[model samples]
Target: MTDHGPQPVERQLPTEEARDLLALVRDLVQREIEPGAAEEEEAGRFPREVFRLLSASGLLALPYTEEFGGGDQPYEVYLQVLEELAAARLTVGLGVSVHTLACHALAGYGTKEQQAEHLPAMLGGGLLGAYCLSEPSSGSDAASLRTRATRDGDTWTIEGTKAWITHGGIADFYTVMARTGGEGAHGITAFLVPGDAPGLSAAPPERKMGMKGSPTAQLHFDGVQVPDARRIGDEGQGFAIALSALDSGRLGIAACAIGVAQAALDEAIAFTAGRRQFGRPIADFQGLRFMLADMATQIEAGRALYLAAARLRDAGLPFSKQAAMAKLFCTDAAMRVTVDAVQLLGGYGYTADFPAERYMREAKVLQIVEGTNQIQRMVIARHLAGAESR
Candidate 1:
């Protein structure tokens, strides 16, 4: 099987261990994931086995504390791993990101007892997880979510639907946010709901334009019962926890965007180099050459932006604004780069015969997920404008 694909990226990892880890990832991607990405994606099949392999190899829990089955790798290192996985297949990369987001509330805010009880299996025990924050009416305005949780003695009953959930039906656990008090952000609370709870169910997955292999569906909680022990963070602190998770998850989205852009650029480069036009390879044409150069430049810039944000996070510095910026720029760059890739390939790019069209389709959703690029600009602008008057 000839992999007429992109060359491996030359990454500047911070440590020899990180370098080794990336090398292992690259090898696995080339041999296992990349080969079947197009075929499976075309069939709209989720690669559950690949996820299992990632979990078994400790690749799934790279950024959390090692005390609870995680690799304790820095955010910088973890983001790069996401980039590599996304370059092979966006489903794998984004899936890992959402899983990490799902674990954030418990890992960062759960009591020691909760962490001791659940962190190990959630981190590395091959269990997949989902984060539920968005509802049908409240995506950008997340604080307006309508999911409700009511306490009954020591137990809580969750009701309402979570929309656009990744891994909706298949996840073993879900980190859910439900209104528990007044009618605003301060009212919401987080809970870890087991997938098989009696009244918990998933609607059919959405018919999406790209990344169809990744399940995106609506989850319903019909009076699902949860113990108080499953609650994450103090009551009324779920919105803050959700925002904190998004800050890190935005970096993951940025990395995934760059990876997809890089992959598209690589495919365009490979195709043009061997393709003949006017008695020579098209790569010799100055017009086409400039387009390739611009694509490469955008990918590099996006990678640098995301890495800078990741490093800030690793240093425990304030990085929310930078994270928003990275997500905005990288996803926009991916959309542009993938479109250029399609144009460079001419008619072939328009068809499913090549991956350029798929890349183009995949790049679009990046702008909309995690947070919309428009929402990202608002976030950045708020940081610049100082705190709101309220």
Candidate 2:
């Protein structure tokens, strides 16, 4: 495949170091990721080797502290790098996001001894991780999750199932939330369960509309035992930790959404500029030009929205409301822009020969993952109107 993806986006970096980091990311995406993205995704192949490369290059752990082998980049720079990766391929971009989410609980809340023991290996040791919260009976109302983790002498025994887990079967570790108290959100606790724990198993990956290369599956924990040392934060703190991670994770989704939309727009522009219709290039049509303009505008707005939220996070300011807004706007914009890209291509957009259709498909999951756009609206509303009555 030729290099026909979107050009590198213009970015405002906080430092010279950030600029160099973005340059390195663009080079990697061009040479390693973009070339085989469509073909590998079509074959349902996960790019484990590419992930290894990312791990080695320190791209996988950019936003964490450097004391534990992370790159120590701020969230602002980290999210832009994510946008660049996502533009090349959603699987790669989203995979990195999920991995970062998987690390959040322990990174944010783990005891100092725990961090010293486990954080370094996790950040750069090439060990993949998964976050487990939603169960078969619970998704949007995640606090109602039924997964149970019972304590015994020095160990916790985990039971029940986690649904829609990214990196389900292949992850080296899982950050799991299970009921350990009474009921609702406050009852949950988080644990770092080894993927190879006895009785831990995964079902076959979900057959999805897009992102076939990224596995999503259900994980079953039947009497899986974990040492108390692996527990992250205090008992009954898992829900809080999970929510904190989502605040950041939602921004990651927003960045990915813009990336996919940017890619689709690039493809649409390239096609219209070359293909002739009614004895002239279709790009010359006024109607088509307006559509292209709208698509570009939406992509830019989404980028700005996500970056604004990321900057708030970097400054250690309250950003939950803005995070929800960014997630809501950016993902919805992605869906609209990708759809328009498909329409601009007419029949070819529906076909597999062009990437617009694939972009459309990939854009859909962004609206659903992290939290659905509907859920984001509720979060923003809560921030504005206060919590709703039961």
The local distance difference test score of each candidate is 0.94, 0.93
Q: Please report the candidate that would top TM-score against the real structure.
A: 1
Candidate 2: what lDDT? 0.93
Q: What is candidate 2's CA lDDT for residue 250?
A: 95
Candidate 2: tens digits of C-alpha lDDT, residues 1-390? 123678778888999999999999999999999988889999999999999999999988999999899999999999998999998899999999999999999999999899889888888998888999898889999999999999998899999999999999999999999999999999999999988999999999999999999999999999999999999999999999999999999999999999999999999998898889899999999999999999999989988998899999999999999999999999999999999999998998889888899999999999998788899988888888865632
Off by over 4 Å in 1: 388-390
Please report how far candidate 1 places residue 121 from its true position, in Å: 0.4
Error of 2 at 221 (Å): 0.1
Cα RMSD to native, each candidate? 1.1, 1.2
TM-score of each: 0.99, 0.98
Per residue, candidate 1 scores C-alpha lDDT tens digits across 248-329 of 9999999999999999999999889888989999989999999999999999999999999999999999999999999999
The TM-score of candidate 1 is: 0.99
lDDT of 1 at 341: 93
